[model samples]
Target: LKAGVVEALKTVQYMGIPQMVVTSTRTEVALLKLARFNILSYFEDVLGGDQVSKGKPHPEPYITGANRLKVPTKNALVIEDSENGVKSGVAAGCMVLHMPDLINTKLEWNNVIYGALDSLESFPEWLSSKQFGMWV
Candidate 1:
């Protein structure tokens, strides 16, 4: 697993920040992966590729996620690790934070992204910074 995923989830849980998985992976497969990693309980919901007509870069997934959480897209904060995910979140009107996974983030995205995270491990600090005025 990537570093600090458990800690990040715990931090968010402690802060009462709701989260959901909006992944291109299938729901069943994603659920199994989350279960295998023992992080299934951290998410409020999971929107899989199979569950949505459109996937990343289409905004449908992120839009559906925010709708499921009963929050407006403008109020949602999307932490993405891929270019397409970032594009989708931006297209959905949510604040997007790029945490590069295998691919290096595009420099041009700096103009559009709300913020950038070095890794998921840094989520606590990022949230605590209050740049976007997080409740916690």
Candidate 2:
């Protein structure tokens, strides 16, 4: 996890929001990493590629996350760092906020992206801003 991710997650939890981890990594590896970071409790569920029939760029992973969270796909918000992840979220009918960790330019899939942020630290403030209302 990033420096402010835990704080952001805590804020979300405080606000009574439900969160789930949907990653392309294997289930055991993802759980191990989250446990190692001591952030496993922050998520209501942790889903991995192995849990789904298909991986990123396919909607299965994110759809499974929404199902596990008991939230409608349209009501879910996906924070993604990669094109494949963004695509998966979009395809699953979830709002995707792209904060690319590697790429510097806009992706060709920008049309589906709900918003773009410079860093994870901005996520909490962004969630509280009027822009979030407009987007949602």
Candidate 3:
């Protein structure tokens, strides 16, 4: 998970975009240890589950992240790997891109969620594609 997160951070860095990882993990000690291994400075902030009033499936977490970044929820783009994450983004009015997970997710929200992407490696490309517009 640490390596994957580092790679994901690198990818975002390559795109010259700022990011903040909002996690539902109980403890972020692993993140602190892993940060030394691959400190991709792109991640502006790293938030834990305890930081917000609610976890996934609620807007609070995502809203907290957007608020911390000083970016409105409407302009935020969330890349989540679980059904609950997807729901949280939708509830927050952010554009969500879901990475496939074991739990099947119903992405019923219109432009709130562009699509469920396949892999992290393909994420930047798919997100950059001119064919897909931002959430309205």
Candidate 4:
């Protein structure tokens, strides 16, 4: 996790917004990471690779997250770092915010991405902005 991510999670939690972690990693590994970062309690649910039949670039993982959260897929916001994760989120009907990490290439499926963010530190401010209101 980034420096401000925990603080952002705190703000989100304080606002009573529901959050879920949908990852390609195994459940145990995901949980370990969350625990290591002391962010395990922020998420309402964590759906990992083993929990889904298909992985990234397929809709199954993100769809399962939305279903587990009991919200419509269209209402979900997925923050992803990879192209396949972005595809999964888009395929599941969720708005995806891409914060590119190791991958530096331009996204070919530009239409599918909601927006590309500069950093995770901007997430909280972005969420409070009018543009984010339009998204919700």
> Higher lDDT: candidate 2 or 3?
2
Candidate 1 residue-wise lDDT at 36: 96
lDDT per residue (tens digit) for residues 83-111 in model 1: 89999999999989889895678899989
Question: Candidate 2: which stretches are off by over 4 Å?
Answer: 105-107, 130-136
- Please tell me which predicted candidate would have the highest lDDT against the true structure: 1
For each candidate in the order shown, give its overall lDDT on alpha carbons. Answer: 0.88, 0.84, 0.72, 0.83
Better of 1 and 3 by TM-score: 1
The order by descending lDDT is 1, 2, 4, 3
Which segments of candidate 1 are over 4 A away from where they belong? 131-136
Question: Which whole-number lDDT from 0 to 100 does residue 41 have in model 2?
Answer: 92
Residues 16-58, candidate 2, lDDT per residue (tens digit)? 7888999999989999999998999988999988889999999
CA lDDT, candidate 1, residue 118: 85
TM-scores of the candidates are 0.94, 0.90, 0.77, 0.90
lDDT of 4 by residue, 1-136 (tens): 7756877787677666788899999999999999998899999999999998999989999999998888888988898888799889989999888877856526575777777777778878877663444433
TM for candidate 3 is: 0.77
| Cα displacement (Å) at residue 24, model 4 | 0.7
